[model samples]
Target: MLTDYHVHCEFSDDSVYPMEDVVRDAIGLGLEEICFTDHVDYGIKVDWDSGEEIRWRNGEPFANVDYPRYFAKIADLQEKYGDRIRIRRGLELGVQSHTIDAYNRLTEKYPLDFAILSIHQVHDQEFWNGEFQEGRTQGEYNEEYYREMLRVVQSFKHYSVLGHMDLIVRYDKAGVYPFEKVKDLITEILKVVIADGKGIELNTSSVRYGLSDTQPSRDILRLYRELGGRIITLGSDSHRPDHLGAHIASSMELLKELGYEAFCTFENGRPVFHPL
Candidate 1:
């Protein structure tokens, strides 16, 4: 079955695509299942109904999903269109080491089907704006990024998988860092995740982003398999209509080629694997 495990809609701080329109688009595109993994960066962004001011990045308002409204809309859509498509509630949780308690509180209150634990910002500094990379050499930044990922994976256990496990490469101005340099850290992270019975996400946005490496990089995936980490997921990481369901088939093909037997979807926080 065709599925896009990572999706965003109007609820996400960085996206403006309404939930209804995204659902219709996914159904029209012949997708069997989709999880709305909208953004939630607690420390840097406020909740939509937090009664505080909303922040904007480059003129786009950034706020965490208004959970009450977001889930109600999802439930309504599920009842209305359950026969046509399977819709699952998910969040792309951007976590920092200091914000684990906040995430635990928020997640405990919801019935999320899936959650992508991502390190979008470390020490409250974002890589896209060069805040995290500034005042540091490429090696310094890259090492720091892996260190952060390892720390989160070791400490946080609420998420289903690590989102774009190697996302730092997307913003590395010095070009792709050598995997061998940080292979030990990456391996340790994967080991901890596998031990914790968690998985990693294959975010296909790398293709549209024109990234030379896969979202988590090929080496990471291979290493996951080598470490006997079998629970992997496929996601387009879509924020717009055109981005929805992109590269899914090719990603499956790639996974099969890499000897990964299955990809996965989630329901109630448990993985349901599908042949690659």
Candidate 2:
């Protein structure tokens, strides 16, 4: 079955595309299954410009998904499109070391088919705006990012997979941070993830960012395989209709070339694999 496990819709603050439009577009592309992993980034306080704590809508600075509305809409869509396509309710959680309790509570409170643990910011500083990389060399920021990931992975256990393991490289202003520079730390993070029965997603957004590589890169994929880690998932990380399911077939082909025989989908927090 062709499935895209990472997707964003209207529920995500950064995305303006309606959830229904995303589902319709996925159906048009012949996707059998798609997961709505909308963003839920709590603990983000800064404005990225003033470097001051922000208090926006509902007294929260960052855009956190409205769980009640999000889940209710997913239930309705799932019932409406059950015969046409499989829709899974999921969340892209921006995990921080200090907010583990909040995430734990949220996960326990909801019934999520899948959850992606992503590090969107470090210490409330976003990488996209260069706040996380300022005053630091590429190597330093790279190592810091990996270390933060390792710390969170070691502590948090609610997520199904780590989203875009090398996401920091995408926003690095200095240059592409070499894998060798942070491989050791990444290995540790991967080890913890595998040991805890978690997986990693092959985020296809690299093409969107003109990276010429997947989020974690091909070398990291090889290492994950070499370490006996096999729970892999493919996602376009698309925020809009046009990008939905983008590059998924190519990503599966690449995984097959790398000796990955199968990729995964989640339901009720359990993984189910399909041959590539």
Candidate 3:
């Protein structure tokens, strides 16, 4: 069945597409299932057009979702269209070392089918905006990024999969960070993830960004498989209708070439594998 496990809608601050519209578009594309993995980044400050901090309920300046509303919307959508398409409620949690407690509390409070733990920022510095790489050599940034990922994966256990394992490469201003530089650390992270029964997702946004590789790259996927990490999922990381289900077939073909016979989907935090 065709499924896209990483999608964002109005719930995510960066996405303008409404939930209903996203669903309708997915249906039009003949998708059998899709998971809404909206962003929930704590401790990261977002600036408005005027450069003002976005505050939350407690008046803390951070980017996070309204859990009550998010879950309610997902529940409503599930009830309304569960038969037509399997809508799974999920979150793409932007994790940091210091925010683990907050993330734990949030996850405990909500019932989620799937959760993607991602490092959108390290030490509160966002990679996308070039703040995370300022004054640091490419090697330093790459090492620190993977080290931070290792730290989080070792401590945080609430996620279903690691989203975009090589996400740092997408925003590195210096250029493509060599895989060999951080391969050992990434292997360690994958080992821990596999040991803890967690998995990783193949985010297809690389093509969208004009990159010539997947998020984690084909080498990382091969390494994960070599380490006995069988649990893997495919996601478009689509923030708009046109990007939805993009390049999923090519991703599947790549996985198949790497000897991956199936990909994973989640329901109530449990993984279900489907043939590729």
lDDT, candidates in the order shown = 0.93, 0.87, 0.88
Indicate which candidate wins on lDDT.
1
Pull out the clashing pairs in model 3: none
What lDDT would candidate 3 get against the real structure?
0.88
Give the range of the ten consecutive residues with the poorest summed lDDT in model 3: 44-53
Candidate number with greatest TM-score: 1
State TM-scores per candidate. Answer: 0.98, 0.94, 0.94
State the displacement of the C-alpha of residue 238, model 2, in Å, after optimal TM-score superposition: 0.9
Provide the lowest-lDDT 10-residue window in model 1: 55-64
In angstroms, give how far residue 149 of model 3 lies from its true place: 0.5
Model 2 spans with C-alpha error above 4 angstroms = 45-62
User: Can you write out model 3's per-residue Cα lDDT over 226-275, one digit (the tens) per residue?
Assistant: 99999999899998988999999898999999999999999999999999
Candidate 1 residue pairs that clash: none
Write the residue-wise lDDT of candidate 2 on 15-37 in tens digits: 87899998888899999999999
In model 2, which residue pairs have backbone atoms overlapping below 3 Å? Answer: none
